[model samples]
Target: MHQVASQLPAEAVASQTRPLLVLENLGKRFGSLQALQDVSLDFRVGEVQCLLGENGAGKSTLCNLIFGVYRPDDGLMRFAGREWVPAGPAEALDSGIAMVHQHFSLVPRMTVVENLMLGQSRGLLQHRAFAAKIRSIAESFGFSLDPEAVVGELSVGERQRAEIVKCLMREPRLLVLDEPTAVLPPDEIGSLLDICRRVADSGRAVILVTHKLAEIAKVADRVAVLRGGRVVAKAEMATADMGALVRAMVGREVKSLDVALSESGAASAPPVSAGDAPRPRALVCDGITVKDRHDAVRLDNFTLEIRAGEIVGLAGVEGNGQSELGMVLAGLQRPAAGRFFIGETELTEAGPAAVTAAGGGIVPEDRHAVACVTAMSVAENMYLNKLDRFTRFGLLRRNALNQAARGLMQEFDVRAAGADVAFSGLSGGNQQKAVLARELTLDPLVALVAAQPTRGLDINAVEAVYRQIRAAARRGVGVLLISSELDELIAVADRIVVLYRGRLVGERPAEPGERAAIGALMSGHGL
Candidate 1:
């Protein structure tokens, strides 16, 4: 990886005649929270500028300001040497600025071409012309997008390509991407970086917003460290090493994974042994096939056995049947065909309650969307799945629930203001920890699914999660981990299964440095 300082000539040394965009004394406040405080930065055409910060450090707020989601409370934005204040998304796009949010924006039922042309303002309807434009753009960007393919049918990588295509169709001079690689496998991350570079080399500017320092080191030309809503360090990517960037972003020197692993005795340690032989099959699926609301098969011939004392990883690019499999296993959806068993009890048509009663615990993929109710208090949300444990005869038992929530919160190390606080008030990492706490505390015979369990978490929190997973396995709990992050999967899983196009295509032992090969298999490049 290039050091940050060597990457830039010097701040005193100017490379270009003019910057493409400049934010002067940018500031935004939400109630008492100073989300962005006097943040100033510049992006030049044909260069990739990476923004790094922890969650809630005001990175999203800054992007929201630039995208016109909320007008800056203070500061001036100049683009292409013109002062600009975009009214909204349309105005922002009109001003040669486009942003792809962390969350997907494409309509699930719409085709790629339809989505690309959703908000276009052509005076006359030109479906054919727009489709042709999409095809041309996709080809130029080395993207194989089926313009007629439904958005819901595309893999996460393909959906991301569609988003990029949507922005490219606008021909924006500056493209902003927020956490673009968060849902991508390690090997696919390189491809995304290549696409970003290609986009920038095409004479446009790219602003990458991410918290992963390794990714910044790989792709950023210029690195800007954001801390508490302020740019603490700005330097060339080639000159700034990960150490320097870590110091700038977190205001402290951070240890690398190797160092951390050694210090924690994670490396050079004997493999933790399972307590005993687990029940023959805690959860079993035989020839299972699942379909979506539209009756499209999202999972085909998926057969798996989860035994106690094992962590089974479902590795794939997002949208490659992982989400649907998780839903089906969790009993949120019933498979169209197949037999599902929890300890020999048939559950093919069972609902979530029945699944839970059958000793299944689910940590859903989308924490906000499906796992927890944002409006509910943390205590309430924590006990949502195990309400019967805290209540009797359909009457509420507030004391028991609160006690359970408090104990679990302490055990899980979930950082929250208070137990009564709304779940939405906590950070993303804390929310995930809360979800884990609830599901794992139930001590189910089988853990249905957990996706991106350590995403957006700090180093310490990640360590905690890893320890939790190990402990669960030691207790003879069957864990089904579904994630795009290959490193995490390899670290926690005993075996890895690759899914491609809604089918189980490959299997391998989880090993370090084998990510590229596994990713290739997941993309259907290997037999």
Candidate 2:
């Protein structure tokens, strides 16, 4: 029997051990774009190396190259003192390298155990043995997962856990995780960080690719900042503050939105509106209840009213019915009970088209799934929902569409070459801006939803989005903002509501330093 030590004491080892993985002069190019250029870094064993960058800043590209999704055009990867070039994912796995992609790659129909064992060596195909191994590994990592559960039936956090287990099952010497906590709730995120620490404690190296600076502060041992496809900064986590890190990533001075708000005189604004401020009720949900396929209530007894000229923020951990609630509000799905009213029109059963036609706009959480068609041109995507306005009878007026697209591009300050460019060619921040421009141009009475709105965006772009949302609210458009980032919610929302296990657990007027209270509520504690 293998008897591994349960814990390693502080005095047990030397600090000068060689790194487990090293990249020297890594360069990768795709057509005209140089995704990664002459990047170099070393990942030490039993350490968490945090990689931070803005969208399209070559963080993902570096990960893809390291994991063998794309080979580096000019680079040398050395693992355990041996030169290595992984030809593909399979080869990478065989060479003790494993990567969990930012986007899920599991087949929904497959069982958890099946997905876990999918790419295992042929010798481990025996069902009983494979299941046993998966369970054992899951237990070791403090992950609770049902081997027989289908991937489609699992929550987002569970699915992520399964991915981690799959990587662990290979006994990888170096593990690469991309945006692993993007879908997790705050409490669950702590658990994930614990898992990462435990994995490293087991004498393996971990590379965490994320944009969240707070997570880096909590868990990273060392950090590497990438900007414009190059490693701009590398330093010990203890020696870096959030301000310093932000400056390193963006190459500019950093200031919190709160500070900016105070400087702009928004801090003196009244917490709750009073007097004759139009008091227009834009959105109302009357005792709404939504059930999933299993007849379980995903949203229960949910009653809320969002007034025009206000932003209502929903704060919760993932899988607390935030997605379902957002979908229902956006009219993408019907509520099982009660009704949603836009002005006086009941929209409980209204389809997406009807809701959109009623001056309701949506920026869905899953961008690729609901927001834009990646393969289509920016102009075509811009006119997707408002095509009829630009079209004359049955034929599309291409010139009008292009004209509108160009106008929106200039208005939103979307940093793309032209409207004719494909949506996929733009960065994530730019794509989100495009979607926002399209949705807001309709002059909607109620802008239904936005999830993680500022995620993957640089400071300047995030500020632009904030300004747009604030302007919309000022124009008497009710806005619903859903995000796990408490700082964001507090920055923009007039009111904040916490969701816990499919129920509205708490509500508070937005105030400074109220995040801790809201976070407690989100974790199922009374505030």
Candidate 3:
């Protein structure tokens, strides 16, 4: 446990009304692991309370206890000026508490309206009015949704919108959101924060659990830092800075994204001299065009070139051809026309195996589906694309493979039960790290394509991924980083390009001041 400074700021002092929910000396354990201990906090009405910490820091564990998903071994909790104990989520919901999980709990086969009316006592026709009300609320928060739309057909952001609507339908007095921005785009994060602010202003309590430090400054009225399953620090948002929050969470000084830019002197791309020759090409996409299963044009004559020792970032909103482009680069999807090359070797119409054999690496957006086999052991997953190296006389060298897996796990700092453990048992961040370790460690790597590489990662894990990408670029590897985070693109990419409706809308040097322009381009506005 760390020493928490017990000084209240002006805002915290003035807003010290009766707390909506209070927890005192809360403690919980799972077998030998103490998930939470001595966690005490007060969540006040009409304010946003943020639980800030790295992954597995007891943030979600505390939320589960409040939502009745788990029973705290030792604690005292009071709600509405009375002792409160709930048996399950239904009891908690009926008591004016609702939790929106990181992974939504809506039934995919049902319509949005049907999903919202699942446990309501009201009739089905009454849900029509509820649907109208939800639409109005979503509009106010700049969310566009269709109540009649099937949940399975909704995009990631739209599904989150439906999840919020479901929570609001219950009129929850205390609303808890876990990692709300994990699947949202960079631009949509502001809108989500605004929604939280609006909910708090409506005289309701909001508890936001996230590891992104930037989010704390954006919406948190009060911030609680959890570390090693304990409340290590607590301070009013007005009094806490990023540096303070980082120290409390990780117990060390870590360079934030902005600070890294300042130290690198690469805030903006440098100008090329007239005499400078064109850089040697590492990856080239020549007039490529693609379509989806529905015959919707996904890539419209997309063309781009990346040079060795350079990083080119692809930025766009979801469903704006980024996914299709990444698939084409990884040789998973056959482009309708045009072709791509790896360092002068043409790889048009090639499959994923040939592309990997040609020294190309792919870190997909969805690691589970494309990168690793969840049912396989960690060692087997590491050699998924390169199993030939460990095979002899039609048999796999199990001992040699396990030895290599151990070495790679140690090098990647992968925290798992063991190399023999199934990949599915690992956390999301660890799974992504495994993919990176496998892809980046390839010999004679020519080009690397990473899509949303840091999605759902904690601060420490994000830093590690960034360092690995930077190291790859330093080794003269051409890198294509496709992400929704503009801040991430500007931090490391040499150039940033925007895709809109399957077309290249704009291209610019990665610069700090160009974010607004890039955002406009991403939304299919001005070039």
The backbone clash count of each candidate, in order, is 10, 0, 0
Candidate 1 is scored at a TM of: 0.81
lDDT string for model 3 (25-95, tens) is 99987656677899999998778999988765777779989999888999888987888788999999989
lDDT-best of 2 and 3: 3
Best by lDDT: 3
Query: Which is the better candidate, 1 or 2, if ranked by TM-score?
Result: 2
TM-score of each: 0.81, 0.86, 0.81
Compose the digit string of candidate 1's lDDT tens values, residues 379-426: 999888777777788897887777778888889887555677788766
lDDT of 2 by residue, 1-527 (tens): 00122355433223225688889999987666777888999997778899988766788778888888878898888877788787888888888889987656788899988887776666637877877887887676555678888887566667777887787777788889988877665656777777777677667789998777778888898999888888988889878777777888888886787666556544322335466555667788898888877798888978888876778889987777887777887788888887887766788888878878787878876676678899999998987887787767789888888878998888887755577778877766678888888877775556456777775566766767777777777766778888887877888888899988888888987777787798889888764
Question: Runs in model 1 with CA error above 4 Å?
Answer: 1-16, 251-276, 291-298, 343-345, 367-369, 372-438, 443-445, 454-464, 513-526
Off by over 4 Å in 3: 1-16, 30-32, 73-91, 104-122, 125-134, 147-155, 258-280, 292-295, 330-338, 341-355, 368-406, 416-428
Note each model's CA RMSD in angstroms. Answer: 5.3, 4.1, 5.9
Supply candidate 3's per-residue lDDT for 32: 64
